[model samples]
Target chain A: MKSPLSLEPLFHVGPAGITEPVVVSWAVIALLGLGSTLATRRLSVIPSKGQTLLELVVSTVDSQIRETMQADPAPFRALIGSIFLFTLVSNWSSLIPGIEPATAHIETDAAMALIVFVATIAWGVRTRGLRGYLATYAEPTWVMIPLNIVEQFTRTFSLIVRLFGNVMSGVFIIGIILTLAGLLVPIPLMALDLLTGAVQAYIFAVLATVFIGAAVGERHKPVAPSEKEP
Target chain B: MRIDWWTLGLQTINVLILVAILARFLFRPVIAIMDERRAAAAKMLGDAEAERAKAIAAREAAEAESGKIAASRDAVLREAAEAASAEREAALATAREEADQVRASAETEMRWARAAEESAASDRSARLAIDVARKLVARLPDSARVDGFIDGLARALASLPEASRDGFGAGERARLIAPRPLTAAELQAAHDAFARALGRPVDFAVVVEPAVIAGLEIETPHAVVRNSFRQDLKRIVEELTRHDGVHR
Candidate 1:
């Protein structure tokens, strides 16, 4: 078997290589897109159960964004919700035999982090002027510019590392246990892995909302109980 | 660690595309429909409130109209009662007046009828008195009654007005009316008594008139001396009739 840390190329398109993690990510995307289409296609004023579930997921995403970011969820809902769904589905894909979770790989996690980083800058520039966005680093004093600038990259890196470490550690530990013992031995660990995957998804989404909210410089909504402290 | 730049870029693109697709298909549509439903509910509530206000106004108007109608009806009833009362009073007054007129007419009729009866009784009494006087006169002694009448004529001639006495004395001839043919001695005695009372002799022609009853009537061209039962009875009858007419 290939190393868990490295993704072998599944195939090649001309000179470019198509890796297994990328293919898995495509499948996750396709699944999410198809679900979104089917769920919203027959929306009505009165709802059936399936439509109710769809609305519940959307409202829950909106609520999380509002509580965590302290801003209206309209501008941030798509990016944050997509990141959560992709991470959750990719991570939980490990339940299928011989299928490794995509987030267990560093490349997928880095890609999602990069997206959040770029989105933060883009939203900040759009919400405040470009000068205002750059000026955010000079909060407290001019001397903190270097530290604040470093913290921007460091925070994006932290978002990537946190999700990758949790998902990869669970996958690695489960793979080692499954190799050492039989599948039964890793069952509880696998359940714990599922829980870890869902948590990681939530953390990734919430961090993205926080980063974007800070960039936008608006706290329109009320904060949650846990976030009430500084 | 090995990183594939191509894979990182591809996944980023895929996530961005997914974000776009979900925003279009799910979030925006659901939120828009929710907004529409909320607006429709608010509009329906506003319309219901307006309708309730209209219903209340109409009910109040109906109540006011009912009150006005009741007031008008009471007024009409009062006016009608007043009119009926006036009509009743007028009818009673007219009836009382008619009754009073009928009673007065009856009283007048009774008085007239009584007067006529009394007048008739007076005539009958006068006629009876005259007949009785005539019977008494016929039963009297002829010589004595004739002498009494002669003395009455003397008394009447003495009481006469001077103009009447002169008119009697100047007469070419005086007429003597008696109830019957006087006796020659009664005639001579009456003539002498009248001449002695008048201080002049009055020539007389005797007339037998039973209508004089037993007394004698001496008359000249312009003067008269009536001393007869028939004249007395006639004067009494006239006075009774005049008195009865005044009563009527």
Candidate 2:
């Protein structure tokens, strides 16, 4: 079996090498772009069946974002919606023969986690201002500042490891089983892998939502009956 | 697992591109459409509410106008009834007045007709009485009539005042009238009778007249004596005519 870690370069664009995962991601992007354009080409007050479906998806994402962040979904709709759709599409890409899901790679997962990390900071700064956002690390006590600062990078690292580990393990197990037992014997494992891929994508999205919520949410405070306004 | 910097950069770029595409083509347009539909629905609801209010107001106005019309109609009907009643009463009063006038005129006409009838009857009676008396006296003997009238004339002359008797004696002439021509004997007898009643001599000329109605009439310068059926009949007719006028 080939090493799951090593990417086979399909082409070169100057010093940069275009790999299999990169090619597959471009295909996913193209499919998503084309679908979006087609679905939204003619919008109406009275929705078509296709438009109903597209709206349902968008609204579901919007609701999920609102629920998780406990804030308005307007500013974060595109970012969160894009993340969920990309992750879901990448995880499900294994259904296509000869296509390796981009989420199964360490590089792709790292990039996604890095995006979440940066987006959280940006949103936090926008909501609380740079000084207030920085001040959040010193919450509860000034002594917890160092630990709170470490927690940001650690959580981002955990997101990458979690998505990459789950997708890569599913791919590896399916491959090993298919090699040992015939292709038909590995069908159940492949189905299980599909489930695992879906779960991993969902977990990644949920965690990203949590991180972004923490960044943009109102500063945590203890509830006291005496402190409540009339 | 191996990390590839190029793959990482490529994936990041793809995700950004996807987000941009989805935001532009999908999220923005879909959200805009939803907002527009919501706004349209609200506008339609507001317009429906306004129309309902206008309809209610119009219905109320129509009802008010109908009420006013009904009231006016009733008032007009009342006035018409009053006018009709007044006109009926006036018509009845006029009819009664006309009936009374007709009754009064009929009574007056009856009274006038009765008076005229009575006057005619009285005139006829008077004429018949005079004619009957004239016919009776015409059947008398001339001598007997002359003698009877001479006797009445002598009595009337005796009743005269002494001065009037003296004046008769002094008169130039005296007239004597009878309803028929008098005989020579009747003339002489009349002169003697007058002279004896007067107790002096009286110049006498006898005049014969049929209009005396078989009676005698003597005239002197100061007095006259009438004892004629003609005179009696004239007085009786005048009295009857006067009595009829007074009764009427």
DockQ of 1: 0.50
Q: How accurate is candidate 1 locally (lDDT)?
A: 0.85
Candidate 1 on A25-99: residue-level lDDT in tens? 888878888887888788787778987787788889999988877777888888898889889999999988888
After aligning candidate 2 to the native by TM-score, how far in Å is the CA of A79 from where it should be? 0.5
> Clash pairs of candidate 2?
B179-B210
The per-model lDDT (C-alpha) reads 0.85, 0.84
Can you tell me which runs of candidate 2 are displaced by over 4 Å?
Answer: A180-203, A218-230, B53-248
TM-score of each candidate structure, all chains considered together: 0.67, 0.65
Docking class of 1: medium
Clashing residue pairs, backbone N/CA/C < 3 A, model 1: none
Clashes of 2: 1
- For residue B146, give model 1's deviation from the true position in Å: 12
